[model samples]
Target: MNPLLTASGLHVTFPGRRGGPSARAVDGVHLDIGAGEIVALVGESGCGKTTLARALLGLVRPTSGSVGFAGAPLSYASRDLKTYRRRVQLVLQDPSGSLNPRHTVYDAVAEGLRIHRYAGDERAAVAAALSRAGLRPPERFFLRYPHELSGGQRQRVVIAGALVLEPELLVADEPVASLDASVRGEILALLLRLRDELGLAALIVTHDLGLAWNIADRVAVMYLGRIVETGTVEEVLSAPRHPYTRALLSVLPESGAEPVVLAGEPPDPSRIPAGCRFHARCQVLASGEADRAGVSSACRTRDLPLLDGHGRAAACHVHGTP
Candidate 1:
């Protein structure tokens, strides 16, 4: 199947203060989202998941590499950029921050239509969008301001605003991270429903592994600006091959196994560790066991590429060599 969105070797860097080295937020990453598919981009904070999403949406220009949509490259030139923005909408992390506090729900949802110059009736479009986002009796909420609604209702308003654009793909950055735990499930279910009902594809950036397990068809584990592992939800989460992935899953409250506590924080992006970026914190490399697999030197001294084999891909020297 042809991907609706594809990004390859994307790198985004920000110049440092006082003439220091640049910070490589996104370092040589690649990803794809097929039509009607839901892919979860999961990682700890500062791992560049959000930066990659912004690049994919054309909100952030990459320092290097290309992003393609529907088999053609994305061009930032005026009209093309506008059209791409219309096709790919972003659902931000914080509903309160994303929505205008003073704007009524109807105005919030209709703003996109006006900005994009929709030829259709704005009221009907807003109504349909609100309804699709699970805001039933949409009329009841139309005149209410952001402050008048509950947290979940506010999030629904944000989703409705995105739906108003009728976008083909949604780049939702931590869509549920700010909501109450009870509200998280509702938002996730809404995303699933959007995919099933509207045939919308989504690239959800989140730190919650459980959220990925709940709604993602595939999971890509990002660490220190790179995708360490990627595979179907069952494959990556059930039997993670990468040591980083295993450590992440091992700490899940329900995993039963003792949590594998990683030592030290992730290295700074400006001064990334040589070779395998995760080597300093990798328990496997610290222990003598990796030597038995004959990949210890490679793990510490060589930059492992994301090797694809079997049904999944991982950037680890000792993967599948037990």
Candidate 2:
């Protein structure tokens, strides 16, 4: 894919607290976000979705592998990194936490411009960004604080902060997770509009499959710091090949399928299991399906090849067979 952002064999490791095993926060991840394309990085907590997004945004250095932007490999040098970050921005999950209560909306949105030493009219840029983010009558919010606006409005302000810089890519971490149900749709629509109008690509980091279904063109299902499935939304969500993906979808209130209540402990980054990394709780293996297919032993003993996170694929021995 001709992508605006790309990660190849990306791995980010953090030493465990108290000298425990190092946590593989992001391990061998590969992803591509094309211009105007919205790719959802879906996974539960500690599955490394956020860490992967941080790596892509150049917030954290990868322990191994590489990140590329606009066909050029990411540079970590001070000046180059600053330039690189200016083209990519992050929208955090909580509007309340991301926004500075001490700063007025104007100051919050203008912070990036000030940091980048923008050369144009700061007031006009802030107004244009706020308007672009759907905060109409931009001056109305110039004096407001985070507590003065609704959750949706606050989120719009946060988005405006990112847009002020005119970034090519937005890595939004659960952009609407903190909003009320009625407000959630608004934020999702805003993201879509930004893409359609400005040709801005986004990697929305969320665990909500339903959200991915509504806003994303593509979905990458991550588990234990590795992508197990990747494809167009219709392909992966409608016909999910990975067992973990299937389980996640089944739990959605609208899926109608019986919920696949996963047994065993949740995935641990500090001590990842061998084999499928998901084999311990796989329904197919527990139901004797993998055994019938003669792959149960492999699922417990063999690790699947690292996924390049491209095309319609699943990295499962029984289902995807990579």
Collision count for each candidate, in order: 0, 0
Highest TM-score against the true fold, candidate: 2
For candidate 2, the TM-score is 0.98
Q: Where does model 1 exceed 4 Å of error?
A: 306-311, 320-322
Give one digit per residue, the lDDT tens place, for model 1 in 1-322.
7788998888899998899999999988878889999999988889888889989989899999999999999999988999998899999999999999989999999998998899988889999999999998999988999999999999999999999999999999999989999999999999999999999999999888888999999999999988989889999988888888888888788777678999988888898877788888988888877888787887778887643312378888777432
Expressed as tens digits, the lDDT of each residue in 1-322 for candidate 2 is 5788899999999999999999998889888999889999999887889989988878899999999999999998999989987899999999999998999999999999999999999999999999999999999999998899999999999999999999999999999999999999999999999999999999999999999999999999999889999999999999999999999999998899999999976677888988889998999999999999999999999988887767889998888944
Query: Distance (Å) between predicted and true CA of 164, model 2?
Result: 0.6
lDDT of candidate model 1 versus the reference:
0.88
What TM-score does prediction 1 earn?
0.96
Give the best candidate by lDDT.
2
